[model samples]
Target chain A: MGKGHPTAARAFVDNRERAHWHDTALWFVREKRDRQAGSLPEWELLRETASSIKRHAQSQLADYLLQFEHEATANGAVVHWANTTSELNEIVTELLQSVDATDVVKSKSMLTEECHLNEHLAEEGIDVVDTDLGERIVQMRNERPSHIVLPAIHTKKEEVGELFHEQLGTEKGATDPQYLTEAARQHLREKFLNADAAITGVNFAIAETGGIVVCTNEGNADIGVSLPKMHIACMGLEKLIPKLSDLSVFTRLLARSATGQSITTYTSHFHKPRRGGELHIVILNNGRTELRAEPEIRDALHCIRCGACMNTCPVYRRSGGHSYNTTVPGPIGSVLNPSMDPKEHNSLPFACSLCGSCSDVCPVQIPLHHQLLTIRHSVKEAGGLAGSKRLSMRLASMVFKRPWLYKLTAGLGKCAVRLTPRFIKYSRLNVWGKGRELPPTPRGSFRKWYDKNGGSGGR
Target chain B: MTRMEVAVVGRTTSRDLILNKIRAVELPDVSHPLVDGVLTGAIEYADTVGTFVGSAESVGARVHFCDTDSVVDIWHDICEEFGSGKTANVGIRGLNDDDLTDDSPHSASELVVYGTSGILGVAENAAIWVSDRAINHRVSLCLTQHLVLQIDAKSIVNNMHDAYAKLQDVRDDYGVFISGPSKTADIEQSLVIGAHGARTLDIIVVEG
Candidate 1:
């Protein structure tokens, strides 16, 4: 009823050619994931184990966080806890200022995006350069990332060529991917060398070892942090697992599920700060604590941010990532966003077609579609449904309770629909019929036909 | 806000509040996952070195096989490939016996970085394990334009499970499992060989 998701999705699908390209592109990734998962005979067992580990970790999140903090501190790294996004941003800003860092280089971090850290840093006159090629492309173009793994999936090579030509002075109209990527390589090389600080998102924070693992294909995170004198890692509190051995389970599933790679090119373990440098880890609890309180939907926290759900989702593939209007998108985003703020994001849960592909591909088996269904029920119970929708539901429930009334209304409704004009049938009041046609009335109701055919107790 | 107010707001109250919230949540006790033997019968290669070379090459890395007696000739060939314009900077930690280092300044932006392998290589993903202690400088592996890793031919493992088992015994500050040269398909799903790290990865396997 809010119409936010549908309106945005309509805008995305209006460009039929681009919409088709987007759907095919994502489905291709999904197919690749299927192939990668099929290569491993223990893929299902791995998923079960990963899900069980996450369940254990989430149940004891407080203890794990405390242990991680203690070990991280003992390793001479600074640890900070932020309860809100603004607090997270302020903590990062203060850390950057403490190091007197005016130029900061960052790898792909969804946490920073959620905290709006770039905008916050810009207000304070600190320059932050996104070092990931996809992130940098979107940064230069002044756009949000459309996908988590492939941020620039929505932008074609021609668009990227133009953007780099304008920003990095590449040869005009050079739409070749290698050329565009090389040009960006040259451009980001300078930023990485001169950056005073580097920030990255933590993939998995090992509690037993008191370290973090940052995975990337381009090695941007490794290069970004290695060059700078200060490294700041920001992560949601849900990223913690119990031990270093747990990575064997997750590392196997992450890249295979995301991009169909056996593993990312570089899975660098950051255990300690480099000599003459500092490592600051910020653990953010922005809305995750509240999510943890909800028993029915708390399994959503097991997500490893693999983006497989988005790749496999039919609605997400067709609608595009921008339709969700959240930091993370697709089936996971629908459940997470509404839980964070139901009033604004209540429409997200209804965006799905309930196909259940998301749950099938989830590496940790998050039961994403089930969570979406639960969120919808909660939203409706909280009176988030529109007035007309609520009234219509009440009317349908009343008619459904009485068999005689239902049959009479069904017979009359068929006549009414047949008598109605085409324009009136497809009018604004009929939300479901906007992009669809109404079925022609049957000769009679099935009950009447069954009674005539002498079916058992049909009358 | 004043500086005092900012400092006070940044204190430990938020940590306490978050911990309190987490502690209050009542959840069913779930045991840790049993990870032993989930993956059994690792994939074995009849010819380990051949499979390693093929898999490495498939991932855009050049592979050379030689014995200890031919190590110098292989090093010379690597040098000749780079030509006289670029002198390779051999890391002092692992490649001291190879005699590949010249009087170069060990610049951070060196075109070629030669180092010896630290641990076993995984045949399944063609990934070689390197740790901080094994390499002279950790940044050299990432900053160099070309990375040359000298590995022993017999240390190749069958899969990742064996690779992790080997790594768990070593105590080091940092370690990485690099499968190939830095690559990205971020732009329109186009595979580009080099992005931020080494553009060329050459693995030379010497007889153990």
Candidate 2:
């Protein structure tokens, strides 16, 4: 989707205010992570175990998915399979139509956003409202989430108060967090109680028990799912876990990673609906089967949907989620979005500084930076590289492949840098120099230095 | 009279043709083909649950056994020594109006012993979850700061399925499984442990 408010989204993606806001939000999550990590002595071991469980689940996802479909159907949850986003929309729309539904309440499900569910539902004359406070703010403003956990993070309290004032007509200057929270609570309470259906994202789907594990703060999901007549859960194929026992590691890590709490305010498990309620689980395989096929990049599927990697990523901490132009962003997004559409997302792989902070902090230990590099190489192989970038890389590769030419090229580069005008202090090749001064090239190459020093360089 | 008019109207009307053409058609077989060879178990691993216990005196939680008998005496002494009565709100499980009559002769100082869910180990950061099913009132765990969970120590498991299976038998009412103190560190990296939920948790494990 292009910017809903084209000017605002563009400004948020590229402007300094948005960058600072996103960085602060991510740092908050990072700090939460450190606190949670410090609470448990077995944190590292827990992370390792969690990573292993996710890996196992992703490897046998096909079997587990089939098993889940059978069990979920048996449990009275109508199972829907959608190979593409449009297909997913059609299936969900038909399901809604079967019941003659009009209004839907949704919790914070990134998959629904990924599939553009709200827009499609709107076109069908159904109103979809996001019940989560953060998501509601973003939805009201016609903007996508800037961060997974805190969707409206880029907007400050006053900005939110202003928006709420304009939309909900609260007091003109209500900047109090409690007041704002209470207002949202009252507003969403009505939506949840009245909506014909509820939509949620699954944190973990247990194959053994045929249950969907939904973790949330503020208990919004619990209210949304329990109160509505129909509950629909949309999940990517990768969200499955093999055994119910495996939930311990994920549940433990999710709270610690997300908000530094031991667990969410609510961890709801729905196997089958109650007496009057109906349940539906839509399993989507848009690109995950293909993602599973790439061995080098398959670890990307081990993601626990914890935003820890995004919080710890330097590039993501600087550039908000909107900059990536995908529902999921950061290092994980760079790898995952490309798998869905390499040509469109080729620019994302190179958006990082190759820092390993994401890998270090990842609970599942998906080698995110490494996967981004792998995706870059794959994009290059597929000839998705831009014309100018391809030409530049090709020329550099040619020179480096030939040592004599490389030396000659280095000499010319040094001469050009030395002779450049003051207005052009450094070559555009100098990215680091954009923020800091460039180092002066030595009078000659290292070979010349070695020759003059008689090859005894060290003191 | 209705049949003749209907036949005449049907023969005379393009509306009949339009209505006939508007009959619902069968939908196409649109199920997405399932993909093969998805990896189910090659990624990450972790055990899901953990359990721990602390005495009423040591971890700041009170014990309520519901009588002035020898067990109550022992529990009071333990609560006094552990500083639980000072820090915790306590409860007893499954006691109704019938159980606490004058013949029982419970102590005057014995606080209201509600229901017991399970023992809880609360991190100092003030986060906890107590099973709503386990407690008589959900507020027994939510309203208190330091909770002393008094349960049979053997009930603990390493994952949620054990708890879930246990819950399946009694699905008529509400049940809460608390983890730690209620907490939210969402405001600008500040780890305010007791934002709006519980502040501290201490599980007083009675060995017997």
Best by lDDT: 1
Q: lDDT tens digits, residues B1-208, model 2? A: 5954653453334222322222222212222111221222222213211223221222223333332234334444544654534222334333222122222111111322222435333322112334443222233333333334455434444333234434443332223455443333333332334322234444433434
Write one digit per residue (lDDT tens) for candidate 1, span B119-182.
7787867888887663445676777777777778788987777677667656467788898899
lDDT of 2 by residue, A361-404 (tens): 88887888898888889989988776767888899899989989
Off by over 4 Å in 2: A1-14, A38-41, A404-412, A425-437, A440-459, B1-176, B179-208
What CAPRI grade goes to candidate 2? incorrect
Error of 1 at A250 (Å): 0.4
Q: What's the lDDT for candidate 1?
A: 0.84
- Per-candidate Cα RMSD to the true structure, in Å, reads 3.2, 10.8
Q: List TM-scores for all candidates, in order.
A: 0.92, 0.73
Off by over 4 Å in 1: A1-3, A399-420, A438-459, B1-9, B35-54, B85-94, B97-106
Top DockQ model:
1
CA displacement after TM-score superposition, residue A198 of candidate 2 (Å)? 1.1
Among these predictions, the greatest TM-score belongs to: 1
